[model samples]
Every structure is written in structure tokens, then in C-alpha cells.
Target: MPDFPFDAETHRRRRERFLQETGGGVAIFCALPELVKSRDTEIRYRPDSDLFYLTGFTEPGTVAVLTPHDEEHGFTLFVRPRNPEREVWDGPRAGPEGARERFGATAAYPIAELDERLKGLLEPADAIFYTLGSDAAMDRRVTELLRGFRLTRPRSGKGPADVRDPSIILDRMRTIKEPGELDQIRASAAIAARAHAAAMRMARPGIGEWELEARVESTFRASGPTAGTAFPTIVGSGTNATVLHYVDNARRTEDGDLVLIDAGAALGLYCSDITRTFPVSGRFTPAQREVYEVVLAAEEAAIAAIKPGAPFTDIHEAARRVLVQGMIDFGLVTGTVDEVIEAKAHQRFFMHQTSHFLGLDVHDVGAYATADGSPVPLEPGMVLTVEPGLYIPAADDVPERFRGIGIRIEDDIIVTPDGHEVITRAVPVNPDEVEALVGTEQAHTETQRHGGEG
Candidate 1:
């Protein structure tokens, strides 16, 4: 079986692009190390996004070397040798043989030979493209190799003269999604949309946050055509929603609380991120709907602003303007929209940026700005997320009804020739649809209790 679903040609194209950007530089990629959760239990292993993106090989104990100009070994793999004994316990491996034949490596060797083999690959290169700080052992090996090469420079007189971060080349490539990558992300978005709808239908007072998390994740697992979550599933309710990055999911939702779910699924390593906030009581209170409307408007406006040639920050600015005005209208801050935005006074309620590059990683790989420090222009094939949120703490200064409320609406978007497509609309983002969907299970249970007579 192939380690990844993508055909070797798909990866070849990406690598070709990377090499073109690097101008035939030597590059090194080390797969992530498997981690131990505790004594003998191992955490589920995932490949580094960059390595997986370039090579479509998702194995640990592997390193890939790219010498772009060397036709014979332009792309080399150093990987774990297949062992029957270990396979019985830890599952199958794509061994070095598979590396070349299955994954399209020009040359392959056992990982044990990397130190001996890598020296030759780096000797004639003028520049090296490698990111440090991923693996300590790999960092040391590369540093020592560079030192040794420096010592031998008088004799050989040829070695890598500069080391550049691969992200400089990779970020640009990843930001613009290829057709295949966009397909994967679209599939991922569909799964996440279904999962969100499932969770929303089941939401009701007295439900545990963890239950919502499980419902959404179970939907991802059962409906996959997916690898797993893009990141940890968040099911924050009430005040917890105000605390960004809250993944505890231990609290029991009370009536009228708003549940903020920020979840995404990984489909063939590409990802979809979506966030939807809905009321727990089956219907949103006037205040909850009012707050949610602001966020929805902001999210919609931001997504609408995504078009070819528009700077990426245009989306942020559009969303920020809406949020700032919403804050002003709500009296959360006392100023005009422009005044509030200029002072960043509304950031207290909406602390995060409105959009981010979305694809392989949740945040994905992309530079927000050009080398000149200006925002990058949006182009066809770019995928991103438009999420706008407001969090009002239960503070004495806040209006009583607005306090303890948090709302965020997010959708995955793809930039197209004319404009953008919002892929995550499979699930409802409109407040009416959200209200109609939330607590459907509870309502159905009630109808059953009454013998189908409402």
C-alpha cells in the first residue's frame, strides 16, 4: 500500500516547484520523531507537514535529501529498513526499497547510513535549504557535518556557502493550493461541516462539553475519508468560550449558553478549519442572536472581500471594521468604528486576526506579506479561513445580557479567478438555521416522550 494517497507525480510537481524556487540548492528534510505519551505507550505519529508536502512520505525515522541539480540522486531518502519482527508490533513500514519504487526517491538508503551518505550530497552544493530546531539530534548532525565540511574546504574547495530556511521557498508554494490539494481540502471541509451539524443537532442544556467534542470527532472518524482532526477539537461553552484555545471540554452546558466549536478534519493531509457558535437552548435569546449576527456579518464581509489581486489584509480590514462598529453599537467601547479600530480598542473583544492561510496545516504554510513587507496579493488557488468572533466577559462594566457571551463564525474559503468559494457552507452558518438545528435531538426526545404529540 502507498504510504500516502497522492500519486508520486503529485509530489514530483511540488518538489519541482520547490527546487525551482531554491535554484537547485541542496535541501534536507527530517521526518518527525515518534513520541512516547508515557512508559510504553506511543502517541500517534504524524509526519512533518513540510516533508509530507514535498515527498508524500509519512513515515517516521526518515530523512529526505534533495540535490536539485543532481539528476541521478536529485531526491534521496534515508529511511528505516523494514523489519518483520518490529512490524508485528508497530505495523508495516515503507522501507528503503519502497522509498525509491513506491515514493519516487531517486536514491534510497537505510537511515543508519545517513551520516556517511549525507557528506557527499552536501560537498558540491553552493547553498543548503534546511530548517533547524525540529529535531535536536538532526540539528547536531547537520551542524557537525557543516563544521567538518568547513574543515575540508581548503582541499575540496567546494561546499554549501549559505544555509537558508526552506520555508522561504515552501511558504509561497503551499499558500497557493494546487487543484488536487484543493480537492482534498474540499473533502475535509465537507466532513467537518457534517460533524458540526451533528454536534449542533445534539446540543442541549445539561450536555457535557466533552460529549459535544466526542459527537463531532466521532462524526469525523465515522465519516472520514479523513486521517483525523487537523488539531484538538474545541467545545467551549459560556465563559469558557471567552478564553481562546480552551480545550478542557469538561464543563456541562447550561440553558442559554453559547457553545463555540472550532474543529477541522484532515483529509489526505490537507485540512479544513471551521468554527460555529450556537446557543444551547435550542433557540438563541435576543442578545445571543444580536451578538452572533455581528460576528456572522463580519465573517461574511471578510469572505466576500477575498478575490484575485486583493491583498490578504483586505479581508482582515473588512472584518475588523465590522467588528469595531459592532463593538461601538453594543457600547462595549465608546468611539466611532474608525476611531475604535485605530486605537485597537475592539481587540479586547475580538482578539484574533480574521483570516489565515488554510490547507495542509490548520494555519497552513504561507507568508502573509511579501519580501517587501507589504501584504501578499490574493491569487487563484489560495485557500484561507474567514473567522470573526466576539467575547464578552461577565464583567461589571459590561451590559448584563451581553456578559458571558462569546460567538465566532468561521468558514473555509478558496480564492478563484473571479472571487472566492466558501466550501464549509454544507453546515448552516445563518442564525435561523443554527437555531433550527441546535437541540434537535432533545426536541425529538421530547416529542417521543409525548408519544409523538408535540
Candidate 2:
């Protein structure tokens, strides 16, 4: 019910661009397949993000073909057929008839006829563009079809053509998002920001970390059914926060500890990723404040370098400098910033890059390769997350005051022609602003009404 109608115009334009790049080859893309949870049970189904981005069609068992080579036949779509009996349990699908008219496909066919139909479409084309080896079932089907086509003899016998990577052409187009996509991503980031704020306000001693995850998810769901979390929520407290990919969220919050919340909300298929570390008691202790400020400074520095024409690696290096300097200041290391970075000493507390591209997936895809197939450059319309973290595990080498203190500050940002735009501003990151947002009487009222926090 929360799904929006498929935008025909968008699909048409996307096909046009892909066709132009392929120069008359056939491109094959499949919808994400459903997964099973247990015996006779299935997990919630979400369509593949790439397929959804182009067609806005989230239904299963769909395949799209863009042909730039064969002028006579192009833009073919394959979909499921209507079956009332199955519709009673699942749902009615847009059959071939509806797909051709609604999606601007040159022709449409039932998925059942994929093998029979694909053979003819594959011929006359110079090359086949596909994500080969990605889906073993689809791959096997395609291979079998190709093998059969090769054996069959037409009145004028000919063999099948070659296969190529469609990513080479499509990745270039998907890298720069359109205006509509940017708008959706911005809205998603705002929702995620509010969700992070809600989690901070609800965090408290005596409550399990999972309670904070619930609060974060509840804020997203309250917005709309489509506004559920984009990924698994990470609500880690104390030493657990030191684990970068922590997602269990089962530990209990305790007095004098900081909670690290990494979460996001999905709005209209667009996603936003955000992480904020705040005090569980609504105020940071001296040690917690010290580490949080350092991470915040590095995050700000990383974001400041997000301008057009700047290298994506530049931002990472900038944040690295800040973290290295902080490490020296805290007496965790004994060297200058350059010396520490060269020696790779910063890996002790900071282990990952400052940011990565964020869009449909948390780590969106594109031609990360340079023009010569090396590292790519930053450009406008690219959205990325600037997250800088400092994690100090409990160890003898670490200063006693710095032990078990971990902090990460993250925000979603968009590159502009001149500079960048911070999309997740709704979530306060400042020490004072975060304290104020979580310390209000309204927050306490909600916590009390929830029957002892969770």
C-alpha cells in the first residue's frame, strides 16, 4: 500500500541513456528474488534497488531489456502472468499486457516465455550486456538459452554473439543522480536525523541497548509505513560501541556510559545513513566529552572538503589528519600528525575511511575507477556520508582515562557545483545542541510513559 506508482517517463529516459551507451546491444537486468526465512516461511521481500531506481516497479519476477543495436526490436520487458488462485495468497502482478502499455516497453512477454523469447532477442545483437555470474539461476538459464540457440539452425544459419559487462556503461550513468533522486535522498536524510535524535532522548541507564533501537525504529515507522529503517540498527553502549559493525544491540545501558547509535530511514526508496554518540544519562562525562569532541572535529573537517573537483580520497586524508592530531594530544601516541599517518599508527583508534557514497544502498555503486580505470574524482550530484570515529579499547597501552571510550559522528551530504550540502542537519551534532535535544522534559515524559524506558 505504501508503494508508489511506476514512473513511465523515468523508465523511458533511463532506457534511452542505456541504449545510447550500448550503441545497439541488449542489456538484461533482473528484479531481486525473494528469500526464505525458515521451513514454509519467507522473509519480507524488497525489490532490488537498481531495478526499483529505473522502473519504480517493486513487484517480483520482472526483467527489463534495453536494446540499442537492433533498431527493429528494443525495450522489451518480461513480467509474471495473472493468476487469481495465487493472487489470493500473494498479490496480482502486472502481466505482460500491463507492462508494455504502462512501462513504455517496445514489447512485453510473460516470464514463462523468457527462454523462448530471449533466444531471438539475443541474436542480431553484436554483444549481450548482463551482470553475468551474479544470479546463478538466471545465469544458468541464460547460458542454457545461449547454448540452445547456438545448436539450432535457422533457414540462414548463424551463431550467437559475445557477452559483455553492462556495468561499464551503466555505472557511469548511475553515478550522477537526477534532481528527483536528490530530493528523495534529502527527505530520507531528514527522517533519519529525527530518528537519531529520538534514540538519544530515549537512551538511559537500566534499559537494554535494544530499547534504544526500538525507539529509533518507532520514530521512523511513525512517519509512514514506507519510512522504516533502511538497514539493521546499531545501538551499542560502553565497550560494545568500540566494535565498528556492532548490531546485536543486546547490552544494557548503565550509568556513566555513552551510547553509539547508527541508523537510517528509507523515504520513497531513497536511504539516509547517520550515526551519533551521546550520553545515556543526557549529559557527557569528562572522558566521554573528550572523545566525542575529537570525533566531531574530524567529521566536520571531512565534510568541509566535499567540493566539486576535489578527490574523494582528500576527505579521508583530511579526517585522518584530525584523528592523528587528536591521538597525539590525548597522549595515546607519540609522534607528529604526518609521522603517525605515515607510520599507520592512527589505525589503533581509527580503522576505516571517513566516508563513502550513499544512495540506494548504504555503499552505492558507480565507476569508482578513474578515467584510466583508477580511483575516481568527486563530482556534483553525488551523495556521501562523512563519518569519523575514534575507538579506544580497554588495554594496558591506552591511557586509563581514554580506555573503553568510543565515539563516531556521521552525516549525509551532497556535493554541489561550488561546495556541498549537509542533508542530515535535523540531527544535532554539537555537544550543547545534542545535550539540549535529549535533556528536554518531554523526553523524560515519554520515557516514563513507556514503562521504565523500554
Candidate 3:
């Protein structure tokens, strides 16, 4: 699909880097299995992120074997054999021949031959790098293979003595954005930004939350044939917004209600995640504006602290300080900002963290802290989301006007050498700008009523 974005050389380079980290070991990667949705129907299949990162192969029943020091045959692929009858039901397969010719594999074999081939590959390797416990079937198969290898160790004098998880190297590599990955992430962010803008304009009283969900997904699909949402869209209106992970979009918007939309798009395997809240009536109430401004201030402060060399915790601290102070100023809580933060009293309204790693997966792989339990420094190639939210439920402790209000502003930012870049700036976040865009719905409706006479 879409020519796989990168060539086989790029994948080979990544594999080489991984090999360097893994040292003299044989690494094995298996693609995820297809799942049955019902009695016979199957859901759309997506390749495992780890396997795809190394081979650029998106087919199921495929396994890749890497031998770092092998001069003639370092990379080997085992894929499902091509069958004419199965080809009619499913799509065409790369087959063993195509795998060697197109994927640059040193050698290729049918899936049925994997067990037999593993004997030769693992005989000389002292260590094995694999994702243990990920697949029970594969785990059993590998265990049996190792046991078989041990039985022959007296005759061959070699077998793996250690096993390691490949994620130790792969996760760290994925944290830093490469040039090709940045292009895909930027494209996905741009499409998601446009979808958010369209949803903002279409939001109005009496509109069902599912309608906005439909509009967002349709906009993403319209952007490109390969584009689709990275996650299930979150379109919560009114009180439903208070629920953190609300997906039941069954409520209808009401006057003076705030709709919080958390959505993103997946383009070329890279993902973008963004969240924006706006007034359903195109005008924020006084109480809504008060809370919205606080969350906005927190987001801005967090984004400002995202420069390279800054501690990752610094960003969250900057946002938390502003939110805690704002809560005190609004009379929602009664304590100094320091006391409130120390006691975590502000968590009553704001609970989640201010940021997260964003990439191929929405909550992408990356270590936030070092082995010593200290915050890691932000690097130039790291990309993250800065999101600050305040959700106030209906309780006696909360003020009447501020109850049932939820507002969160999120954006994707890339750490630059000197500063940070906001990749999703295509969508407006200022309160006035949000109102201006949302007001266009009424203007369009007016024009349609008069049959374009205006």
C-alpha cells in the first residue's frame, strides 16, 4: 500500500542498527495473526509495528530472521506460500520468490519450513532476541525448537545460552523521529487538523454526537484513500465530556454546551493525536470561558517548555503550576498553589498527565525516565503531545456554573534544536478564532435557505 513509503534499503539500515545493538545474536520477528470478528468475517489486518519497522512487510503468517555476522545470508524471510485457490479469496501474496527479489531477503522459505530452517539458524547463535510472551503459539514453537537444539548440542557443540527482548533496542530507536517518519507524521497531523476544523464548524445545538463523529471520519477518508483514523474518535457533548474515555456518542448537543473532540488520523502508518474543545452554540458561556482559558494557558506553558535539553518533567510542571493557580483563582479550590500541588488536590479537576509520546502508535513507545528514575532530557528528534484538561463534575464541592464542564486543548509538538515546532497549528485554538470558525455554520445555513441568493 502506497509503495510502503520507504525502500528496502531503509529497512535494511534499521535492521543493521538493531543488529549492532543486539550484538552477536539471532533476532526473530513474527507478524501478528489475523483475528476473526464473527463466525466467518475477519476484521481488517494490520501488521505488527515492530515487524513492519524492520522488514516493511505487511503480510500475516510471515517471520523474519536476522543474523548479524552472516556475510552471505544475514536476512532470511519465511512467508506463506502462494496458492491459486487462496489467491481468489484473499489477495495475492509476495511468495518466497518475490520476497527474495523484491524485499532483498538473502533467502526465503515457505511458512511450513520455518521449524526446519530454525535448526540451522539457531545452532551457532549464543543468544536469541525475541519478544517473549507476545504469542503463546510462537512461544511454544520457539521453546520446542530450543529444546531440540539442546538435544543436538553434544553433537554440534552450540546452542543459544541467553534470550533477550528486542524491545530494549527497538523502543529507544522509535523514540527519535527520522526524516522519513517526520514526513508521514506531518501529513497525518495536517489531515487530522482539517478534520477537527470541519467538526468545529459543523457543531451546533441539536446535532447528535455521532453526526460529528461521522463528519470527522468522512473528512479523514476524503483526504486520501490510505488515510484512516488512528483510534476510535471521541466526540463527547455536555455532561458526557466529563467521562475521560467516552466513546458512546449517543448524546445530542444542547444549548450552552461544550463538545470535546479527541481524534487523529493515520497516514502511511504514522499517527497523529489531537484534542480540541469548542462551544456547541458558537459562543462560550462565561463559566465555560473561565475554565477554557485556564486549560489553554496550561497547554501554552507546557509547549513553551518543550525545547531540547529540557527535562521532560519540566513541561508537566509548567502546565501543572498554571492549572493549580487557575483553580485557586477561580475559587474552585481553597489553598496556595504549592500546597495544592503538593497535596495533589488539583487532581479533582485535572487528573491525566500533560503530555505523552506520539508516533506510529498514539501512546508511542519511549522511556520517559532513565534507569536511575530521573526524568529524561528532551531531544531534538522527539515528538510529543501537550494536552491539559479540566473536567469538573456536578458535586457540592464544585461551583454551580462550573459543573459539568470539560475542556482540553492538545497539540503535537516536535522538539527542535533551539525550540519546538507545532505541527498541528493548522487548527485554531484561540477562543475568538474558535468562535469565528464555528459561526460559519450559521452563515452557510442562511445562504442555503435563500437558495444562494446572497
Backbone clashes in model 1, listed as residue pairs? none
Task: For residues 1-454, write the lDDT of model 1, one tens digit per residue.
Answer: 2245678998998899889888747999999888999999999887899999889888899999999778888999999999999999888988989899988999999999998888789887878899989778878877887887788888888888667899988988888887888888899999999999999999989999999999999888786444678899999998999988999999999987899999999877788999999988878899998889999999888988999999999999999898888888888999788888788788889998988889888988788888799999999999999988999999999888899898888999999999999899999988998889998988888889899565
Instruction: Name the lDDT value of residue 199 in candidate 1.
Output: 96
> What local distance difference test score does each model get?
0.89, 0.81, 0.89
173-252, model 3: which lDDT tens digit per residue?
99998988988899999999999999998888999999999989999988886688889999999988888889999998
* Model 1 vs. true fold: TM: 0.96
